[model samples]
Target: MEFKNVSVVKEANVYFDGKVTSRTVVFESGEKKTLGFMLEGDYKFNTDAEETMEILGGDMSVQLPGESEYTLYKKGESYVVPANASFEMTVDKYVDYCCSYKK
Candidate 1:
């Protein structure tokens, strides 16, 4: 997938001591997205807006809110996170992903 006519922020959103990083992309239609990658590690993310995370490459095991087990998602797969909720992810090696926010 690709985005056209979008503005990308130079400054990255760095997390977990830079284990996870992303750049914000603003579209002409006022939609926002972040393209990033995760290194081998476990992570937990909290969202203010609802988010759809698509795996671009590699894979991850995710535990959504209130879920006890992590579900594996490979490249080309996606998952949704509810607003004001949180999710956990386990990346074996690396994962390339795009996250779109719905406000």
Candidate 2:
């Protein structure tokens, strides 16, 4: 099964590694109901999807343009980004995760 980028996706300066290995995951695909995964070191997170959920892993801070801002998602935690709002993220270590949408 292939995961389509049903939503606009993009990433910058994203990396992943644990002690002795590493990889780069900057992906985007949208045409069907989908899930996107990415590994980022320290970068900005932006989205325009009606709702976006972060699933899997990461220890980063989420920045909203105004009123609300925070970092979320890791192992069993997740978050939904508000529509029409832009956000950003930063991390100390490599972060891994998947995004899902109903577009």
- What lDDT tens digits, residue by residue, belong to model 2 across residues 26-98? 2354322223344444555456665555544545566656746565556666667666666676655545555
Q: What overall lDDT goes with each candidate model?
A: 0.96, 0.49
Model 1 stretches with alpha carbons more than 4 Å out: none
TM-scores, each model vs. reference = 0.96, 0.50
Residue-level error in angstroms, candidate 1, position 71? 0.2
lDDT of 1 at 19: 89
lDDT of 2: 0.49
| Per-residue lDDT of model 1, residues 1-103, tens digit only | 6788999999999999998999999999899999999999999999999999999999999999989999999999999999999899999999999999996
